[model samples]
Target: MSVHDLWDGLPKAEIARRRQKNAVRWQRRWRGPDINPTTGRLAQHKQSYSDNQKPQALLDEAAQIQSPHQQGTRSSSVTVGTLLDRHLAAKADRAPKTIEADEYHASVVRDTFGDRVLSTIDATEIEIWSQRAEPAASSRKKQLELLRAAIKRGVRDNLVGVDVTEGLVVSLRHTERPYWSSQELRAVVDAASSDFDATMFRVLGFLGLRENEMRTLRVGDLVGNQLTVRDSKTRAGIRTLPVPASVLPSLVELAGSRPKADWLFVSPRRPGNAVSKGYANAALTRAVGGANAIRIDPIRRLSAHGLRHTFAAIALSEAGGNLLSVSRALGHARPSITLDRYGHLAPAGLEPLMALVDAFAVPKAA
Candidate 1:
């Protein structure tokens, strides 16, 4: 019978199936067959010749066509581990410190959800995991943020259909940090063991600089009493501060022997490089301990950051409770931010305002 007559005799489903089979057969024939139909063996020789003859672009396109799972819609086989690997690989270009932090966060995520397919991890599952994890508020927030960022990248790469982190509430609790008083700060400075430690303590206390910023300081940054902070945590943090007279001699003494291009706080073990955070932390801890021995209420929680808070508290008092000056001194993006953090330390309400009012008010009839 003719092919048309045979096709006409077949049921609609059978016809459709035959048409699909014929189409596949024609495609294989046109592509020189990937498999031998009779032997059911891969046509290795044919594939080798095809691969050798094909251009790189054509080969890539063909690979994409063969493996549709990697491209458009999310695939059920892609797991959280796979997405994290891809995300971290992309994050290699970020700052080393930032990459290290990302790796730490990724480890936490991998421990929880690594094996689960990306699409299978829904909001409910994430919420449950988060509740079970019960990490500190700050750490929990960072972990969720990292996961959300990685999932977003997965979505862009077509590995995930939806961002499960969406609508999941990761509430962050505000933890109060301890602020040091002037006496406590002075005690720490006096307790510093080495000249370098003493200088570092004085500079940090006077300038309100972050530990990283302090470590990255170059000798040239000190221009007379004005110290130019080039590297900082934020753009607002890149500022120049008038060095307090108390710390000026220490800073000048430290820089007096070093070249202008040299790091102000060079690592003793690895000369020419900036000091490590661990060294700074240890030195600060020792200084705090020593200071505690001399003071009535020993400041047990005085970190490097606490020194900045101490500067803020002292500056706010010295500025007559002016938050604007204190904010500028602290390199805060806004006075509101300074107020939010140090407003409690600000001079009591209405005193300055009442003083202003008194200056303008007419003398009451005596």
Candidate 2:
């Protein structure tokens, strides 16, 4: 038989099946209550792609455009905006600063694809969006993480089909954390415009409290030589630290007879409020300016947080490389976190390394 006549041996149904298998390719069937393209009503959706189209990609696109919601379900479709709103509402109990951060990060997502159907968001779309995001790499990474967390919660709540942010990664450029040297710190303290400014410097450099923590300090928090951290960024940060003798007298004198609830570092501009971050920065700048004017060894301008780091560095060096002590004093959640940032600065000795080997050493055969 001729090539054309060979098909005549088979039934018409088989011939049609072979033609379908060879001539026309169908994308994987996506069964969902999508809007029918032919009839703008909720029905089973079907679509075909050209030879140049990827079956998987076409299927994904169809799914996103068609059935973002469940079939026959009376629930409203969820969007990125809805997810972020829900996420924010759920975090009503978090600290105000934490909530503010969440909102800031959430705004980036909201501004980009907030109205987009949450179910339609895929990893590829997010990755592309992240690349175009205007925030610095670190800030953008935080924003991405916030969006991922919201989507993850949506999935757990059955509001989303999948977590599209599963494997997304944002690379951050590492920069050295600036800190003040001991001599620089002492010069800044000596050059302080007022006794209170000098005391603030001492508190930050000796206590290792964060700038905010220092600003929020209260007289009642200090008891003899013990200082209590009542409020902090994390629960681990709420710790009591032994007051260094060097700063004790200054703190006691600063406390005077102020009420327990009164702020230790009251705002210079706003009397009722705690010291502003701007004031902290300006104080450091002024002190550095004074130190540079007369000193042979000029001081580098540093932020208030740099004093906290200086405290960590000093503690690690003076405490015989006691990582635990430094970590606890700095209110780090874990010793590993402390080690990651300052481990190299720890005093190195063969004795500590040899001790580890000695612990596992076997007695020589007698």
Give the backbone clash total of model 1. Answer: 0
| Cα lDDT tens digits for candidate 2, 76-150 | 356777677666656757767777888788887889878888666678989988776477876777788889888
Instruction: Give each model's clash number.
Output: 0, 0
**TM-score attained by model 1:** 0.51
What is the C-alpha lDDT profile of model 1 across 31-98, one tens digit per residue?
33578787787653311111211232223334543676646634566677767766665565665666
Name model 1 segments beyond 4 Å from true. 1-174, 294-296, 317-319, 360-366
| Positional deviation of residue 2's Cα in model 1 after best superposition, in angstroms | 54
- lDDT score of residue 198 within candidate 2: 94
Candidate 2 weakest ten by summed lDDT: 49-58
lDDT, candidate 1, at 195: 89
Note the residue pairs that clash in candidate 2: none
What TM-score would every model get versus the actual structure? 0.51, 0.58
